[model samples]
Target: MKGFMLMFMGIGHLYEAFAGVHILQYMYGCSRDDETEQTERFGQLGYNGENFLEYDMKTLTWKSRKQQAHFMQDEWNSDISRLDFWKNYFSQTCIDCLKKQVDKGKSTLMKTVPPSVSLLQKTPFSPVTCHATGFYPRGVTVFWQKDGQDPHEDVENGETLPNDDGTFQKSTHLTVTPEEWKNNKYQCVVQVTGIKEVFIKVLTESEIQTNWEDPAPNIILIIGGVVALLLVVVGVVVGVVIWKKKSKKGFVPASTSDTDSDNSGKGVQKT
Candidate 1:
């Protein structure tokens, strides 16, 4: 049977308004003959909110819950590049439980081709960011893969920036007609120099805009602001200097002493 799989982790107990969420899904888990049956089986095996009881309607396997929670809006993480422990749970469908303890299997998918540009939400056209820092793509290749079937298999429009260490890490920004972004699905793929390809989907503007977790404003704005301020300061300084130069010599520098050379004791000998 054919079906999708997922594992969640790092549910840092926080308010529904603000919190980090993640989910892990792998295709290298198992093979199937019937896609619909597989989907049904997996859906039935899905974690139930009533204390972790995944119900398999076919075989009637009431798998006991082991610390599972209700699948909410922000529950399962969509990023495939997660390496954290709790976020690396094996979530697939099979007769027997498929739980493996691989040291670094958290983002197995991301370890593949380049990250894919996500389906950007288009209320406001957002950017798509991608960083290639995985095992497979140590420096393999980088690009954007739209559909999940293939990496070098879709439309790509943007540039790739290389990392400081000669490796490549790139970001792509595209403004979609408010209608298309929200309605379309996109992804960013990273191809390691020699390894495999790792791909990630572009989710939101925030994801791409702040992909670097950057604390600084955009390069263009920051540069522009600094340049403008410098220009203003220069203008003021120039105005002052021009005024000073253009003005008649000030009656001489101001002094504590009176203008009279008399011994007023203001402390200045009459040269």
Candidate 2:
């Protein structure tokens, strides 16, 4: 059976430069238990954070919380029109609004979605992270089991986080060495709320997604590439130095008369 609580609150504040601040707070709500079919309605008023009055549904009267507030209770209770309005609003109008809201959001409130699980490791020696994402209802359990038994040691659980799409995600980490996991059977288990099927992933080298890669295979190639690049760079620098030196040695300053144009309208040309 599904149970729900619906509440409505109204607050008003009057501020005066000399008078400071006066606040009026009204809170009314209804809650229902689906299994018992029990419903309860409540309403209260507060002033300056202190309880001022409470509504008695049976007596249809405002109960004063403070001795000083009795005058207000008397004034409000004598107003038959206001009393009638509240009686109808709480009994009918509030219930109607709650029903409409529940009906409108029934699909989202009732829906359950399963999560996609993954095993991630940042490095070979780092902890194996069990990640579950894109699940709905936000209630899920993620854990690691070793040799078909749950291990409390070296296990860390993370808080559930909400996704932008209204779904949820959670993660758990299992810290174990390669030799330990290799000898024992390790698995990641994910159980989402409202779903009966349990999701499990066996811990294996092939199953782990990691950014770490064995550099032994490419070490020689990488070193050779780096050496070749350094050689090319050095050769280029040497060539540039030689070219600059030769240019400086070959460079000659032009004389003023050689740069001057002849009277024949023919510009002086370099030979």
lDDT of 2 by residue, 44-79 (tens): 999989999999989978999999789999999999
Task: Give lDDT for model 1.
Answer: 0.42
Alpha-carbon lDDT, every model: 0.42, 0.89
Tell me how far the alpha carbon of residue 112 in candidate 1 is from the true structure, in angstroms, after superposition. 13
RMSD of each: 24.0, 11.9
The RMSD (Cα, Å) of candidate 2 is: 11.9
Candidate 2: where is the Cα deviation over 4 Å? 16-19, 144-156, 183-187, 223-271
* Residue-level lDDT tens digits of model 1 in 62-145: 344454433421243332343122123222333233323221353553343443333333234344334444233344444554
Worst 10 residues of 1 by lDDT: 82-91
